[model samples]
Target: MQVVGNALVALVAALHLYFLVLEMFLWTRPYGLKTFGNTAARARDSAVLAANQGLYNGFLAAGLVWGLAHPAPVFASQLKVFFLLCVIAAGLYGAATVSRKILLVQAAPAALALLVIWLG
Candidate 1:
């Protein structure tokens, strides 16, 4: 159960890293446009904003990674909970302001991982 929880946390971190890449490096590219459902002109115009969002995602990822690497078990769990909550909050906000899909795509996984962590 602990291993599963940890793996799920890692998966969430990886997802955030992918998001960082998409928003920071590819926001104006075809892949980013396709993923985001944005037109080329819109993507280009909003690239800076996307990059800023990506940086935040990267910070979340970094926090999760740090939690995973922490030496103290209790502190590690606390860190994980904190970061997961952050992800969930961001996801809910994005869903409300941007798209409903963000809730499922970003928040659901973190919620699952949080459940697992709590159970474990």
Candidate 2:
């Protein structure tokens, strides 16, 4: 069970890292624009904002990894919940304000992580 929890946490961390790249570096490129549905100019204009958001995601990833590594008091599970909540909130806001697919791609993984950690 512990191993399963840690594995899920690790996967979440990696996913967030990929998110960091996609948002911060690739937002204007084919991959990011295809995923985010934005023009090149618009993506470039939003680069700074995406970097900021990506930074937060990176912090969340780091927290998950740290929590898994140190396992003092089920910190991984707790942080996973917290991080997923943040993603869920962002996804909701994005869906309401920006895009719906964000909810599917971003929130879904968080939801999956939450489920795995809780159920496994």
Candidate 3:
């Protein structure tokens, strides 16, 4: 169960990292435009904002990784909970403001990880 929970946490971290790449490096590219359903002009207009958003996603990923790598068990768990909650909050906000897909892709995984971690 612990292993499963940790793997889920890692998965969430990886997802955030992917988001960072998509938003920061590819927001104006064909792939990113397709991913976000943005026209080239719209993507170009919002590239700076997307890059900023991507930076925040990278921070989330970093926090999750730090939680996973922490030396102390109790502190590590605390870190994980904190970062997971942040992810959940961000996901919920994105779902409300941007797209419903965020609830499924971002919030659901973190919620599952949190449940497993709590159970473990």
Instruction: Write the residue-wise lDDT of candidate 2 on 4-71 in tens digits.
Output: 76676677689789889988888888999998789989999999999998888898788777767665
Candidate 1 residue spans exceeding 4 A from truth: none
Q: Write the per-residue lDDT of candidate 3 for residues 1-120, one digit (tens) a residue.
A: 989999999999999999999999999999999999999999999999999999999999999999999999899999999999999999999999989999999999999999999999
List, residue by residue over 2-62, the lDDT tens digit for candidate 1: 8999999999999999999999999999999999999999998999999999999999999
Better of 2 and 3 by lDDT: 3
TM-score of 1: 0.98
Q: In candidate 2, what residue range of length 10 has the lowest lDDT sum?
A: 68-77
Off by over 4 Å in 2: none
- In order, the Cα lDDT scores of the candidates are 0.97, 0.78, 0.96
Query: What is the lDDT ranking, best to worst?
Result: 1, 3, 2
Candidate 2 similarity to native, TM-score: 0.78
Q: Which residue pairs in candidate 3 collide?
A: none
